[model samples]
Target: MRIIKNLLSACCLILVMNSCVKSINDDLSFVDAASAPDKLSVMFDITQDNTGLVTITPNGEGAVLYDVYYGDATTTPVSLTAGMKTTHVYAEGLYNVKVVGHAVNGKKTELIQKLTVSFRAPENLVVTWAIDAVNNFKVNLSATALYETAFKVFWGDVPNEPGQPFLEGQNVNHVYASVGAYTLRVVAYSGGAATTTYTTTVNIVDPVLIPITFESATVNYAFTNFGGATATKIPNPQINGINTSANVGRMVKNGPEVWAGALLTVGGNIDFSANKVFRMKVFSPRVGARVLLKVENLTNGGIFFEKEVTSTVANAWEDMAFDFRNINTGNTYSKVVIICDLGTTGDGSANFTWLFDDIRLTNQMPVGFLTLPVTFDMANVNYEVTDFGGTVSVPATDPTNGANNVKMTTKTGGAQTWAGSTIGAGFTSPIAFTATRTQMSIRVYSPAAGLRVRLKVEDRTNNARSVETEAMTQAANTWETLVFDFATPSNGTASMNLAWTYDMASVFFDFGNNGTGSVFYWDDVTFLTTNVIPNYLTLPLDFQSTTYPYPFVNFGGATATVVNNPNPSGINTSTKVGRIVKGAPEVWAGSFIDLVNPINFTVLRTFKVKVHSPRVGAKLLLKVENTTNPGQFFEKEVTTTVANAWEELTFDYSTIPFGFYSRVVLIFDLGTAGDGTANFTYYFDDISLN
Candidate 1:
């Protein structure tokens, strides 16, 4: 019993000590649920200058962090730790700044501070502006001054346009809508109430056209670039030789495509009918740089034509010509695309750059003016004639030759005595007439022989400066060339004056007689290079004398002319030769020259002629005929052995007896008609008896 009481006393002592330790570890701090962060405020430190810079510092009694909200719509609230400050730029306005402070226990306090941001008047404000170099419609503006915070622009192109805001040292661009001058206004604002406004004038213009010299202030010269090609109108860097304009077009290539180019809308279709050759003055960095000029339809890129040419000189201005004689005129091409250094990628270096000016259209020949030798066979010529005194002239098929085209003229019964038809709407240029060239010829088919055909020439601008001459038609209903000598004018008409500029010509059929429903066909109006009287043709015919008129009577689509030898080597190096172009009309097309007298065939029966043919195995016929009777003729045919070179062809007439034959007739490829191409052209010289 005594031992049990002792154990109980020991356990009771351990329990009392454990209870005392638990009482020492219990919480005794006070708790309040309504307590939160307090004393939240913000300080706004505004700079004294007009620049609306405001520095805000938020503070609170129990705050650990702060959120500052700028009243401007441009920015959101920013979070900052305690004792940190934030700066904000604002225009001159009254704004309410909000501040929120947060405690360590996540309870927040909010405050709204009414801050009045005012600024002084901006001083010495200057606005700098200029037109964009490549784009004339765009204007770039900038400003600099003291106490300026922001800038707003009034482009002056629209009514009630809200100003666009921009900061200092920043350039702003405004593109005008049209091509004219307009007022530009720029306003500079600061932190204070005052502001500075400046105004200037801006001008925009239209795009340039062909013959692009790039010197006009009103021309836009806007080039649309593709594949990294860039172009600008700039002052001429190297102006000499063919191009001396004040400004030029500069092209730089930095593209991956081989055909990178600059295209420009020309606003209208390029008339390729009269002027088929294009010319430009170019200053290339290197020689042999291929430059391509192309034209495309206004909206369709698939309809395009291009021509390429290489520069022959480097670092100097050179004139280049591109022949587009065969371009299709049916398509409408309005855009001009230029590519420099074609077929190669550019590196944006000076070596790949090109300067060009004076983009224009020239003529390979005088295609714009209608001069002599009007055949009515050219594809692009207008050939439109003007009729007077109730006369009408129209293009028609040749009555005798089907392959030839001529003009058919009709005079009504009630027509005037001077009824006539004019050749083209008064020639664009003056007719070439010299002292030795005072005669003109026309092939005419009249209703009756011995009809007086009058040919007159005058200055279209002045009717008093004119000369008229008359020639009689010899054959009726058959083609015959009549020579009109202007040196001997008609009895009452003016004489030929070489000093005047005669640009128009007209022909009158059955002159001095009132029209009685007469119809005539005429063609081949040629201005004779020499007088009407020619030297009579004879044997041993060599076309070397400039004074002798080698008039070969062409018939059945055969044309013969005395020209310089195209290829003057190989057996014949003579300066002059005869060229014959056979066209499509008859299979037996040929030419005959009337000799002054008959040939003496007593000893020499073989005839030899040096001929140059385009192909081998071409049949050449040489025949001798009576001057008046073509039935009494003897002929022999020979074949050529060589091509594009001179060779001697021989014909024997030993079987023919002596006769009065005074005409020499020659025919090439008698059975096959020709198409008047180079392949069907023949050249011959040195005709003699061997």
Candidate 2:
């Protein structure tokens, strides 16, 4: 009875296990094969009078193989895998194409498509160029070909770019900013994929000089005529003992609208660093004629400056100066514009004619404040805010030790931790980073005290020479002069050279502060001239202060700085640490420290540096070189122990030959080129020897 009860319980457990268990082969096992091919598309790919090529594709489900039957020549059909394509030459007639998809279960579904192979290549393709009516620099394209549906034009300015297309025989226009040589290519395409190409070199000679003196009769300096005014060259007449030139420009204004003028352009960018004054020789038809002189960026006409000057001489030539000292020097100006008789219309008579010559820039200033020190006292002060999030910097007159000051208002963009305002000023010449003076001071007036203000100096041409320092505003709404010292080099950064570094000064107000609508005022931006402080040279070389002179002589495009230690280790419990980033493609991107006193290797033979690396077994090299002699150096390589962890790497100098080694070199991943990423950054601290 006991054995029978045990057998019944075992049978019940087996039944339950059979119902709950599943097999791995259940997903692969299927009952039915998939359906046939659908959504098939075909287009003729013909060139040179129908070579008889067609591109066909199909969208299908579960099709592994297809048999295509071309009902033209042969009885045997061609087989293709699902992604494979085939082209066949055919005669000029209708041919039927039958496509059959084969399933995994040997099931087949058939579909038929018709093709008419009638194609002709584009012939007699021609392209012409002309100037646009509205804008002179605009180039208009006219392409034509037989049996062509569209065209592609290659302007040849942008590299590795495909041509832009337009309908065949349709006029297309492209505008060029400056005058130069460009190879223009045009492709005339047939209704299919057949195309014919034509190329021509276009010499864009938009002749118009800044000082438009019509002395030569070679090329008609095509001055853009506007407002019913015709500008041309004429022989200067000795009318009333005035106008003493061989040839002069004449603007004959017709009896239409007022403000008739002629425009000219320069070949290159105008340098405005020296002076902003403009001078011109004008022979007006009458006195008090309002002559307007304007200069604009050749690329963007919107960025411009204009001034109206009244002529004092009537029917005679006199020199006039237009003060443009307030124009922004940083913006490029290459287009020169002029207008005579500003308010009234012209009648094509002698009273309407205006003659001008010798439009040039001069080194003269108006009666006002200069540009140095940037006191914001000048009426033409220039200031613009580069947004960390979004901001606007305006001139404020609520005096806090100045006639006018800069007011910064914050704006929110989405959600950002740090929203700040950066306004910069350009110097006429580069600010030299001298040995004695490498600091700049600024007076700030903030709403609240202790707001962080960062000041960055850089070469406007190259941002790589940029270096920055920050200071906290001490008082609210009170002028406090704060100095930012940049003399102390950190990490492995190359020293700032007076030869090429730091020309422009940019200031950020309330840096790293959260986004809010707070307003701040700043004024009295100046570069300080003070006595230099000597570097405290010691063996330990701790990165404790901003004034600590780093011994790196070369950085090789790598950025380095001192920050809080990411990984603290033995003998490096200090808060400050040195970080070096390999930010260039060169494998030799490294730093070499130049010690004030050479290391005596006979006394101390081993050196150690605490390094926190991204991975284990990374190659880190420490080398010592003679300060006077390069290429004569000793180097040692070591592999890191743990990943993302700090370890001490001891470089043995005992095996090295005896020499006065003052400069120390470091290279991470010495043989591999760094792609300038965050992963290439390395942190180190406590470089000491025993």
Candidate 3:
């Protein structure tokens, strides 16, 4: 009875297990059928010929080998070397190449790849020549043909015949006994039987002497002595008078002739159709003079036009130009003459002497037609705040509440605020503006005491990143005009930004502390651009004030100093130092100095140091290390002299392989002993790169 009960329980457990297996099979049946197949991967690299070799790898459990077809009807056995690459040279065409992978379990997979093949023709051939007058004349040939090919050259005095065949990429050097004319023919044959030929002419002539002259005949002036034909006249005389004794031209007695006949030209063929102008150089005169330049058409023998010019003492030896466009040439005459005179004897004293040189006929017009001075009027200063949609706020009343002329007001609190006004949200309120410049000027004004105003000037593009700012404090109510230089930022976008913030403590005005006070005004601003060259950095003697890390030691004769700072850090105070005497030691760590850009490294080709010590082992070391990763450094040692006088120590680091380094350290290591003074001192300046 017990065995029969156990058999009944086992049958019940088996039935439950079978029911669970059937439920799993039903759930798997819901999966997509397309996703249940084995995957085959095919990969290949494309070559210049447009065809590529492919490799196939199959991955599927419980699978067998079968036949494989590569989409082009080419079939092979499934057994292929693993990881082996094969080549397939297919004709030029686009194809959807596929590899069919099959298993003995009847399961199959296929991989498709889009393949393309292209065929290109050879490129054009090139020929170069090197003519040798003394020996053989060599002609170098090169071609862009991809395959092995033959070439032929036809050589003769006549260019239209075929000659002999030569191999491509060969240099043909032939000698000619005499100078004559020759023609060269080059032909190339490719693998496809396509051919191309090019021809050129070469001429060999005897060398001749070519004379180049630096003459000034292009201008209208011939020499004519004021004293007589025998008087020695300077080429361009500033003041002309008869020296009689020395035969030299001089400005004596009356004023000299500012317009000498030597500075005038006549009887020249002028072609107006080619667009020509008059150009001459003149020397400064002692007395100012008005000279008239008259142009006469020799064909018509009539004065066509005249131009009057005033010469001041400042008119030195500089080029003067006059255009013929506005001049009436009287129907484009073939011959023209120019005359210079003292303009009908008005204040014609002999103190005026003008020299002239370099007369040229040019087609260019004179530049700088007018010199207009830019001026600013402060009375018309106005501004408005407008949104992108062109909506403008009300004309902000001047002296609003207690503040005079709300130059700049902001609603945002904290950094952006206006005193005595209810602060609003968002960027808005009183805008600042500068008057347009007709001439350059500077405007200055004294503001209220304890009041600070921020002034900002930006370029025209409204690119605020380039805006320059200055803070002005009010000390008095006086107005002063300060000259402002506008040469550096000459892009002409110069606009103004004014903002004022007052502390809530006390209201201070001109001599009084009141709620309402007098307003501060500015006027007469001057703008000018000067051409002033800055002084180069020189070595200074105060070594302790330098920012560089130093234990700086001097062996008796050596001396050191700091210089000025330069833009781009060229030779400046921070860079230049002086060292005196021999055997003086100075060392700087590479980590403390700023490494210049990689491009600047090429400019700094060599390291130079000055040494006065006469020691044999005086040396300077320029060491550069990679800061990104430590332990990588390059050091160059320069040897110095032990002479009593100052001597330069140089190290040629032209071959130093430096790329993308972060740190550069320089050290001056003195030898253990030296002459003159064991304590040496040296002067060093211009730590320059290029």
lDDT of each: 0.80, 0.68, 0.38
Candidates 1 and 3, the one with greater lDDT: 1
Q: Ranking by TM-score, best first? A: 1, 2, 3
lDDT of 1: 0.80
**lDDT measured at residue 246 in model 3 versus the true structure, 0 to 100:** 17
- Give lDDT tens digits, candidate 3, residues 228-316: 11111343333232111211222221224433332222333355553445665545454354444445554564656555555544534
Residue-level lDDT tens digits of model 1 in 1-690: 322343345344545665787465333122124245588889999987866789999998766667788988856688776799999988778898998876544557899999988787677888888878667689888888787778899998899989889988899998887788787888888645678888888767666666677887777787999888898999998867877789999999987887788987874678887677788888999999989998899999999988888887899998877766667999999898999878799998999999988888864422235767888888747676767786766678899989999989888788899999888867767878886677789998888875778889999889899988777765679887887766556544566788999888999888878889989999999888777542224457888755346768998898998999999998899999998999988988988886544565655788999999999999899999976667889999999999999999999989986566767888999999998999889999988866
Model 1 misses residue 654 by how many Å?
55
Q: Per-prediction TM-score, please?
A: 0.32, 0.29, 0.21
Error of 2 at 608 (Å): 32
Which regions of candidate 1 are displaced past 4 Å?
1-205, 208-211, 216-230, 252-260, 266-280, 283-292, 305-334, 340-354, 360-438, 442-482, 488-493, 497-690
How accurate locally is residue 202 in candidate 1, as Cα lDDT from 0 to 100? 75
Which 10 consecutive residues of model 3 have the lowest summed lDDT?
Answer: 502-511
Question: What local lDDT score does residue 204 receive in model 1, on the 0 to 100 scale?
Answer: 70
**Winning model by TM-score:** 1
Tens digits of per-residue lDDT, candidate 2, 1-690, equal 432343345445545666687842333234243454444443345444544556555435665556778878868777666677777777556888887776544456777878877657679987888766556568898887886777899987779859888986578888876667788899887656567889988766655554566775543666888888888777776433445678777888875778778877776666678556788888888889888988889889899999988887787788777878568888998888888877688888898888877777765422221244766665534444344454535556645544455554544433244455444445666665566677677766667765666677777778788766556665666666666655433223334556776667666666666646656666666776773322233345567745334646546666667788876655456788888788676787787766544554544788888888877877788888876777678999998887767788888878887555667788888877776676788888777777
Candidate 3: residue 123 lDDT (0-100): 46
